[model samples]
Target: MPQPHGFRYEELADGAVVITHLERAAGTLRGPRAQQFLAEVVTGDPQLVMARWTGNYKRGNERTARNHPRNRH
Candidate 1:
């Protein structure tokens, strides 16, 4: 485990799923600081993550679903 961690020290576990996905890409990350920071955050929690998740964020189908007519079955 990393000593003196600071990522989620006081935050609620609301966005853990998002965080978990990012850690898997640390190796390809271009910045040393970012990679190191992510490592510190995910060290203790296997389920925790830090994903980039930007490829289709704006055009994803899930977002459109919410705004669609709810009456459709």
Candidate 2:
């Protein structure tokens, strides 16, 4: 389960930006959510994703813990 557990999709005038924990899934909005998230704007216009990124939230939390020295473990 190293992959992203959640995904955030954004639509631009010409393409989309999908931010995830593992990788970015840039592609044309030829699917459900893609169309749903970007209504009329892309209404049947088909969305195109431009880029995606993997966020290291877990690593970030670890760094935070190291700095704060939390006893979570």
Candidate 3:
């Protein structure tokens, strides 16, 4: 069967079909840290993920501001 543009389909050994977005998949995480993060995402609630990311962004901005030399004046 022909796949649609930007999408690909694979049939697993167990006969399950997995359809993926080619563009999106290209940007996804790789390596052990990515695996650990994915495991958390798959097992935890979306709200927790949102909260964690929000806090991370907030702290990142704060760190940037703190390290800016102009802030000393």
Candidate 4:
């Protein structure tokens, strides 16, 4: 079936509907430098850090997200 613009929808036999949006293209970052930056931000408030990080991600600032140590692997 044709997928909806910008998203996908699925209906299960159990009468459940699931809709998912397409994820934006991810950006890549090199190693150690990214890890170091993540370490520096680790102590910040989780919610606030994530909000700012996501904004940067959406703006094509993959370098910031890519630098996240967890994302290295």
Candidate 5:
């Protein structure tokens, strides 16, 4: 898969993390979960982290699944 792009995040004053994809709101992480995400994001790849957090990452089988006859509809 291509490298995940268009993912961004912002930290809020109340210890919340707002994640966005392609400039659109995707998810908000608060409290301990937000802290955990922030730690992981800085330590690793931001794009991958955001994609995973936002649940917008593409699985390897997407092309195969999309080409399948059952999915054409």
Candidate 6:
């Protein structure tokens, strides 16, 4: 899969984190989650971290799973 890009985040006055992907709002993190995100974002790859946090990354199994017999409509 390709690398994740265009991910950004903002910390709100109420200590919530708004994570955006491709200029759209993807998720919000509050309380300790927000704090953890801030810490990890600084130390890790921001785009990858943001994608994972927002549940936006592909696990590379979509095609196989889609072709599975149980998943057929």
- Highest lDDT: which candidate? 6
lDDT of 2 by residue, 1-73 (tens): 1333444455656554343323455334535655554564343322222122232324436556666746555
Question: Global lDDT of each model?
Answer: 0.36, 0.42, 0.43, 0.42, 0.93, 0.95
Residue-level lDDT tens digits of model 1 in 1-69 = 222212222222442222222233222233454456456656744223332222322234655787789
- Which pairs of residues collide in model 6? none
Top-down TM-score ranking: 5, 6, 3, 4, 2, 1
Backbone clashes, each candidate: 5, 2, 0, 0, 0, 0
Task: Choose 1 or 4, whichever is better by lDDT.
Answer: 4
lDDT of 6 by residue, 1-73 (tens): 7989999999999999999988899999999999999999999999999999999997899899999999999
Choose 2 or 6, whichever is better by TM-score: 6
Measured with C-alpha atoms, the lDDT of residue 43 in candidate 5 is 97
How many Å off is the CA of 31 in candidate 5? 0.5
Q: What lDDT, from 0 to 1, does candidate 2 have? A: 0.42
lDDT of residue 26 for candidate 2: 32
Write down the worst ten-residue block by lDDT for model 2: 45-54
- Spell out the clash pairs found in candidate 3: none
lDDT of 3 by residue, 1-73 (tens): 1212343333455543333454343222345544554566558653344234223223336668877999866
Query: Pick by TM-score: which candidate is best?
Result: 5
What value does the lDDT take at residue 73 in candidate 3? 62
| Between candidates 3 and 4, the TM-score winner | 3
Q: Which residue pairs show backbone clashes in model 1? A: 19-49, 19-50, 20-49, 22-50, 22-51
User: What's the true lDDT of residue 58 in model 4?
Assistant: 45
In the range 1-73, model 4's lDDT, one tens digit per residue, is 2212343333445543333345542222235534433554468643333334333324455678799998897
